[model samples]
Structures are given as C-alpha cells and as structure tokens.
Target: MNEQKPIKVILVLGLFSFLSALSGSSTSLAIPKIALSLEISSGLATWVLQSGLITTTIFLVAFGHMGDLLSKNFIFFSGGIAFTIGSAITGIAPTFSLIIIGRIIQAFGSSMIMANSMGIVSDYFPDKKRAQALSYISMFISAGSISGPAAGGFIMSVSSWRWIYLINVPLMIAVLIFGHHALPIPKVSIKQLKSATQGANWMGQGLFTAGIIIFFLSGAIFQSRSNWLIGLITLVVGGALTIYSFYQDDVANLPWISPKILHNRPYLVSIMALLLVMLVNSVSNILLPFYFQSYGLMTPFQSGLLIMLQSLVMLVLSPFAGYLADRVNRQLMTIIGLVILTVSQIGYLLYPAGMNLTRIIIPIVINGIGMAFFLSPNNALTMGLVDKSLTGIAGSLNSFSRTIGMTIGISFGSSILFALLPNVDQITPALGETFLSAFRGVFYVAIAISSLASIMVFVRYLRAKKTA
Candidate 1:
C-alpha cells in the first residue's frame, strides 16, 4: 500500500504538470485565430499570451514561499480550482479583454502549481530516488510541450479556437479529483505558518513581484516595436525596484531567496549557467524554423518534423541521464552536457550553403542528448545545495530562471535579426541573402552564449577541485 501511494502521487502530479505545459504551449496556436475572430491586430492579441507569461514568472517565488509557510496541499488545491475556473472563462470569453483576464488568472494558478510540484516530489522521494522521479516530471513536461501545438492546431481546424481551452476543463477536473486524493498532506502547523509569516519580508516580496512583471512586460513590448518611452521608463523603474528588494532582504528577517543560498558558489554558478544555456538553446529553437522554411526551402510541416526530433531524443535520454546523475559526479556530467551543446551549435554554424539535411540531424541529436544530461542533473544539484526547508523556493527559482531565459532569448534574437534585415516588419525575396546572413549571425550569438556557459561550468569545476 505504501509503494502504491508513491506511484499514485507521481501519476497525479505528472498529470498536473502535463496540463500546465499544454495550457502554455497551446495558447500560441490560438493567438492568430483569436486575432481574426476578435478583429484585433496581432500586436494587441499578443498581450493575451504575454499576460500569462508575465504573471506566471512573477508569482512563482512568492507562491513557493507560500507553500513553505503554509502547505503544498493548500497551494496546489487552490491552483487547481483557480486554473479550472480560469480555463472556463477563457473558453467563453466574448472579448479579448476577458481572454486576457482569464489568462492572468490561469497564469497565477499555474505559478502556484509550478512553485509547489517539484517541492512535493523532493519531499516525497528519498535522496536515492529523487532524480529518477524528477526525470519523469521532466518527461511529462516534454510530452505536453510536444503535443500542445499539434493538438491545438487539430482542434482549431475542425472546431473553434475556444475548444483549445475548453478541452482543458475536463482534464483539469480529473487532475483536481485525483490529485486531492493522491497527494499527501504536509505536516505544517498553524503555529509554523504564523511564525513563517512573521519572519517573511512582505515588502521585499511585493517589490520583487512588481519588478519582475514590469521588466518582462517592457521587454515583451520592446521586442515588437522599439518603443523607447515605455521601455526605458519601465526598465529603469524595474531595475530600481529589484535592487531595492534585494537591499531590503539584507535588513529583513526572512528574505525570499536566502543570502546563504545566493552565496553558495556551485548553486549560483549553476544558475548563471542555466540561464545562459537556456537562452542560447531557446534562440536556436526559435530561429531554426525560419532557417528551414525560409532558407532551406522546406515546408512548414517538414520543419516541424525535423525540430520534433529534438524532443524525441530528449524523451529517450532523460531517464537514463537521471539515472546517471544519481550515480555519477553531477557537475562533471553537466559540464559534459554543456560541451555537447556547444558542439551542436558549431555544427549549425558550419553547415555550408545548400548543404544536405542529414548533417543537421546529427547536431540536433547531440543537442538533445546534451540538454537531457544538463537539465535533470543540474536541477538536482541546485535543489540539493539548499536545505530541505527551502526546497519549494529553490525549485521555483530554478523554474523561473528557465522561463526568464527563454523569454529574453527570443527577444534578444529577434531584435538582432530585425536589426540586420533591410525591413523590420516584413521579409522579401530580395532580402533572402540578407536574411541568411542575419540567420548565421544569430547562431554566432548562440555559440558565443553557449561557450560562455561552458566557461562558467568549467570555473565551477576548478573551484570545486580547489576546495577539495
């Protein structure tokens, strides 16, 4: 019965993880349809997506702290209810404003779930089994990410775009019912909760949340148009807010991210590397479709199929990587993964004009294997560095880094791409050669960023050796 309990927990939590991923990914597919249906500009419609990403990223750490102070069960159940209600509202939204509101609600709920899910897993599994269980969570994330676009596309073809959201209603209901029964109650007490609240720096938390939202919101808008007014104003203000938040932590009784955790050499370096690597990898993924369809003369379908291979390789290797992380030197494995990823980017860079597709496949495969190795092990090591009590915040901090990295990566890459092009808004055949040149430049940036990550990992290695 005890054995069965653990398995049930994984299944239920894994379902929650899947639904969350699907919700995020599928929304991209719905954006164009939404613009057409609502008679709105694509630029305005994009706010529907940005609202969700902004809220989710900003609230993760706060909600993770809530999990620690109160109970993981409290956050997860509330998230489920909020997520379900948000999805229904989104499905039935008559106007774009309502859709944005629903997405914000949904994103807040997702933050709660995201902030607590890994913490629960870490708490449930022993050290020996923790990485393996985390690997399954990673796999569920991959499955949902891979399936979302295709599933959404199919539904939109035969039905209204609203069905993309409506379909999640039943799925969330299932997760809620099963998760309520399967997830164990944490042993948090009201006394403990009160103490935690008293100790927490509420002012710092508020500042941090506001800063993150302002920063990301400005960046998202800046990506489409170089609107310096809103961009510079928000950027300066957000930066000030963030700095103040960190300063407040120095005086506060309890900081959102502990100074001890921030000061830890391996964990700090690992996080920097995670952000850089994710940035590079995301830029590569976002640009590759353009490379294939625009330059290589491949169809959209062919481009998607080719890119899907990366996920397939990740799916195959993630479990093995998790197993190896448990047995091997995690830092060593992570460094190796970074090296492999850098090599793959070089492969992309070196592909001769009019080269055959076969050469690209090898690099893509290597890229996948590298990601599989790095993500699971690095995550394990980051969480391991922190004490068990702060696991929830640690987990959310790790997740937030990835999300922020991806967001910034796309914006960075697009800005550079547009800057190099003859026209910022549209691409024409006259600019094919120009676009290819810009494309190559994007890979150069990726390679440089990835190489930087490798250097950081190697520095950690040297530091570890010195300490030893």
Candidate 2:
C-alpha cells in the first residue's frame, strides 16, 4: 500500500459513503410534503422509502462479490457516477412513479458504495490502525444519519423538496473527482486474476437476488391479504430458495456468505444482536415522525425537527462511543446500550399526547445517546470477529442484516398500531390515550426483542471467556 496517498483515498471514499448514506434518510423527511404536492396517499408515498430499500437489498451482496472479482476502485467510481445521475433524475421527476424509479436507481448506487466501502478501508489501513479507521468511517455514517433530516427540513423550508435531490449532484460530482484521483488500485498477477475469475459465484448471486425479490413480494402480499395461509406458503418457498442458495455456495466454494463466518459463534451471535438493535432503532425512527405529525399535531417541519433531535445526539456521541468500544468490553457496551434504548422506548410509550415539548425532548435525547452507544460498539464487535480476508463479505452481511431488520420492524410496528387502534381515524384525537396505547404495544414488542438480544450477548461473552 502507498501509505500516505492511500489514506487520502480512503478518506475521500469514506466521504462518498457518507453522502450516499445520507440521501436515503434525507428524503424521508420530505415524504409528507411530496405526498401532498403529488396528491398521493400515505401508503403510496411509502413506496419512496421502500423502493430504495428493495433495490439496495437485492443488490448489496451481489455488488460486494462483484467488487472482489472486479476492481474495487472501478466499482466505487461507477457507484458515484450512477448516484449522481439518479439524483438528477429524482430532482426533475414530474410524477410519483418517476420519483420512485429514480429512488430505485439511487438505492442501487448506494448499495454499490456500501458493498465495497470496508474493502477500501482495509486496503488502505494496516491491521493495527484498521479499528480506529473503521471508527472514523462509522462517525461519518452517524453524521450522515443525523444530518439528513435536518438538511432535508432546512431545504424544504427554504425551497422545494426537489432541492434535496438536487443537492446530491454537486456532492456526487466532488466525490467522483476526488475518488477518481485518490482511490488506490491493488496490483494483481495474471495467475491470481485467473484464479479469482474461476472462483466468482455468478449462480449464487442470481439465487440471492431471486430470494430477496420473493421475500419483498411476499411482504406486500401479507399486507394486502392479511391471510396466514398465503404468507406461510410464501415463507416456505422463500426459505427453501435461500437455503438452496446457501447449500450451492457451500458445495461450490463460491463467494456467497462464507459458511465459516456464519459458523463462528461470536460472529453469528453478534450479527443477531446487531439485527435486533437495528430493528428497534429503525422502528423508533419511523414511529417518531408519525407520532409528532399525528399525535403531537405538528407540521412536517416540526415533526422533522423532532426526528432530527435523535440524529443530532447520535452525531455528537458516536465518535466517543467508538473510542470507548476500543477500550472497553464490546459486549458489555452493547448490553448497556440496549438497556438504555429499551428504557427510552418505554419513555416514548409513556409520553402523554398533550405533554410539553420539553418533556418529549428529554427522552428523544436519551434514545439518541443509546443509539450512538449501540451502533459503534455493535459494528466494531461484528467486524472484529472476522479475519481481514472476509471484511467485505462481513460488512455486506452486516448491512444486509440491518436492512432486513428495518423492514421487519417497520412492518411489524405498523401492524401492531393498526391492530391495536383500528378505530382511530385522524390519529390526533384522544391525544393521550389512543396514541399511547398503540405506542405502548410497539414498545412492548421492542423491549422483548431487546431483552432477547441482551441474553444472546451475555451467552456469547461467557463462551468467549471460557474459550480464552
């Protein structure tokens, strides 16, 4: 590695990752305004978020494998170019369908960046400094997550929602220029290149994509039909295809999620815990905007401000959390973070509809701190469990788990709310009672899940100690 130049390259790529990551959530705050302008229903507007997620879900792992097979720098630059074009499309889109299409393209670009970012870091940093480098990258991610909503709100307040998409263009252009110059290329011998080509897993990629499509489609079916039988069949079919893909990869020695990583006890347990953490965090994020808009009787901007509070807290605390993780017992930090997170969720459940803003802000800040604590440690531990050779795959798996968890959490949380408060029409009335009941139900489920995650962490800790 060309040490000095490579560090510059890694920082630039990290910035690219940060910006792409921000695009997803930045548009989230604009959803209500966009829906109103386009005369679309909330259900339809939700497609804006789901479209990006679906695209990313389908392509993340496949792109990760592609990164390993092709040049990582090439894939990263391609993602940047694609992201810029998609942003332009979204900015000028006239119809809701067009916007969704743009979002899908944008998500595809984001997944490309996500799929190869860790590999870029690994290429630049030696083993000793890699943890700290990862922590810095994670800080950027946390910053993006926090800044997106705030930036969205500010842009929408001053200009049209289109500006949110438009802003990414310049950002992407900068990334393209910097990345093209800065990204490091690994030299490979002709024989090594030939071996890599033979090892690439095209079939595994196809099966994984098919399985994700089926999984998402099945979710849509469940929402529409509300029938257990149909869901059961879908689940069985999807599960079988997923299993078959795994079996093929194992037998073929292809680049599907390496079985060795999955079989590692610490790695598996950490992934599960990280999934649960993401599920709860994402559900809370989705809920907060709805809570402010519907129950708190706030405008879109106000609701966005409320959501931004958590992100801001996360931005401030994440670097410290990452630093702490380097020195402390990672599992202990995760457990403590989850406990705090559960407590904050409970606070949200208990929040009276008519309560003052000050009261709500306290719990929101607490939730944010918990999130900051959880994300860094959980991520550090998950990555630390694997050898450097599999970092790209491990990162892809981590991203996949979080995406799956977010989808499940949002769906399940919405289901709980609908099931509990079927009669509440406007979502503004009975300010204290109705919303609280529904939110409480969601919290109960989240708490249970967090508790289970805690147990898993403890068990892993004990086992690790014994082995040591």
- For model 1, how does the per-residue alpha-carbon lDDT over 276-378 read when each residue is reduced to its tens digit? 8888878878777767776676876688778878877888898999999888888898999999999888887766556477887888888898899998888
Per-prediction TM-score? 0.93, 0.87
The lDDT values for all models are 0.81, 0.76
Model 2 misplaced stretches (Cα beyond 4 Å):
1-10, 32-42, 93-98, 126-128, 157-160, 186-203, 218-244, 423-425
Largest lDDT belongs to which candidate? 1
Clashes of 2: 0
RMSD of 1: 2.5
Off by over 4 Å in 1: 186-200, 227-240
- In order, how many clashes per candidate? 0, 0
Q: Number of the top candidate by TM-score?
A: 1
